[model samples]
Target: MRMPTRILLGCDFSSAPTKRKNIVVAVGARQAEDAVRLSALHRFSSLDDWSAWLAAQSAWVGGFDLPFGLPRELVETLHWPGQWAALMAHYGQLERSEIRRQFSGFCASRPAGGKFAHRATDGPAGSSPSMKWVNPPVAWMLHAGVPRLLAIGAHFPAHQPIPERTPPRIALEAYPGLLARQLIGRTSYKSDEAGRQTIERRQAREQMLTALLEGRTELGLKLDIDTAQANALVEDGSGDALDAVLCLVQAAWALRHQDTPGPGYGLPPDIDPVEGWILCAKRP
Candidate 1:
């Protein structure tokens, strides 16, 4: 039997989206077992706009570049609700300042080199600790992003039950850095600061894009993009578009494994419900 095509989305999210650094979503679909075709790229200048856009989508399987859940150790230590849904609800009510205060206190109590608690997926995925509020500010990403997902009632495999609806809107936590590092190994490929956007970063972006086009990654997927799309990804300098496409590739991998025997969407069978796993991230 032929399977229907599913729209795949890869979001490079921003906690405080603005006209300058808007959220970027790469829209695409799997063309074959080893290839994905980029159809469009959408940008939203505000969190409300992005949330509304996501809510309006009929169906899709997306890999979003945001932490879906906080670390279990952090949650337990803070005595927040241990359940994922309840925890998210509690977290949504707290102001960002309070969150920072608490997380800061938690860090102050811990020893050097281990200030932040980590999720199991963080190590293998090479993701920042969900509790970190600076540098990448993923904690803010979770604050701004997850509530919107819950508001739209998107299905998160293992963490949230699949809806009974005919066409499901699925979301998976994804980190483009994981795939980028696999291809370029710690070479910086992007910088939001214009002064830091050097030719070397552009070269690095090109290198990763070439690897994706050649199907050289372990995910066994190739990216089919036009010259314009390729050039845009490399020239943007922020790498938001490229990161979204990288996430799109991961979403494609998850879609291919959506019917696997253990935990659909290529997630680990033992994935923590309170601390969700990243799609296609290797188990440690």
Candidate 2:
């Protein structure tokens, strides 16, 4: 079976997608070996629509800004299944309220400050705990996102890779901040609130755009977008569009460097399946 050459996607996901805060998807591909082509920036106004679209699509590798698993410590303490697939299936069957109640009880027993347990990947990826239900609400995102990936029959390279599937629709747990931080270094680039979208933030976005277009990062591949397109990406003060693009860059990097094997597409070799590592996350 002939695989689809260079197909990639970057998704800036939301747990509860609304019209005011949509999920942004950047569809892209490689062109001329060194150029990354961003074909579209699609905004899904609702989770239902996003899930439907994800299920209907195939033949691309995507970097999703969502946690793939919970901390093993938390799961074991709670006496859930130790296996990855069994745990996910068990987790997928519960209602949101049930999950919240269970996680909340776990936190209540622990001390203040660091109440929740974290996955090994959290430190390097700079990601919130998969069990964190508020603020970023990553728990809800896992509740919404993972089941859909399973339903779509997408291949999570970290979790499972079926060799027989042609033109594989591979999914990797991706965090855009991992790459964006490399360029901007603690600078804020986006705000969901229009009033909070300051000039400095806009400049940060511009800096990121320029960096990607010029191949300034470790990724080595430059964008194939026109000047106008590049400007448009920076103009979105919310940063969702740029985030999707950043994830696309990560996927593109993984695609270009096929030899960086292991489930993580450059992640550590002994990555925990129950606590999956993010793509490009280096071992501590």
Candidate 3:
């Protein structure tokens, strides 16, 4: 029997999206066992608009570039609800200011250089702690992103069983930086500030794109894009477009493993319920 074609999505998210910095989503489908075709790129300037778009999709496996859950240690230390659903409920109700205050306090009480609580997957994925509010502001990303996923009732296989639907809408946590690092090895490929979008970063982006097109990465899947799409990914100095494509690739990888035994979707079997795992991240 032939395998079914699966819709794949990669998202480069912004916690507080705006006209200047919108959330970018790359939509594509697997063309073969080792290839993905880029179909379109969608940009959302508001969370509600993005949420609506996600709800309308009937079936897709998305790799979202946002922390899905807070660190287990942080949740326990803050005395938040331990269960995934309840913790998201409590977290979604809080204002951003309160979250910043509480997280700041948590960091201040701990020793420097070891202040942020980490998820088990963070080490292998090289992701920042979800409790961190600044720098990358992933705390805000979690606060904004996870609630939307929950509201949409998407399937999170690592945290729970697949929903009994004809075709499930699946969301997997993804970190684009993890994939980018595999190609560039810490080279900065994008920057939001115009002053920082130097020639070096552009070259790095070009190099990474070349590798993806040439199927040189460890994922063993080649990206198929037209010249226009390729140019757009490189021209957008913010790197949102490229990051979205990276997430799309990860989603493709997850789709390939969806039927595998155990956790399916390349997620670890022992993934934390309250602190979800990043898809495609190696178990540590």
- Tens-digit lDDT track for model 1 on 41-132? 99999999998998888789999999999889999999999899999999999999999999999999999999999999988998899999
| lDDT rank order | 1, 3, 2
Output the TM-score of candidate 3: 0.95
Residue 146 of model 1 has an lDDT of 93
lDDT of 1 at 145: 94
Q: Which residue pairs in candidate 3 collide?
A: 10-248
- Candidate 3 worst ten-residue window by lDDT: 159-168
TM-score of 2: 0.93
Model 2 agreement with the true structure over 222-269: per-residue lDDT tens digits:
877877778878889899999999999888877776545565366566
TM-score of 1: 0.96
Candidate 1: pairs in clash: none
lDDT of 2 at 192: 91
**How badly does each model clash, as a count of residue pairs?**
0, 0, 1
Judging by lDDT against the true structure, name the best candidate: 1
**Reference-based lDDT, each prediction:** 0.90, 0.84, 0.89
Model 3 stretches with alpha carbons more than 4 Å out: 1-5, 162-167
lDDT tens per residue, model 3, 1-284? 33344579999999999999999999999987999999999999999999999888877899999988888898999999998888888999999999989998998999978989998989999999988888989999989998898888787776665554424578899989989998899999999999999989999999999999988878889999999999999988999999999999999988888877655788776778888889778986
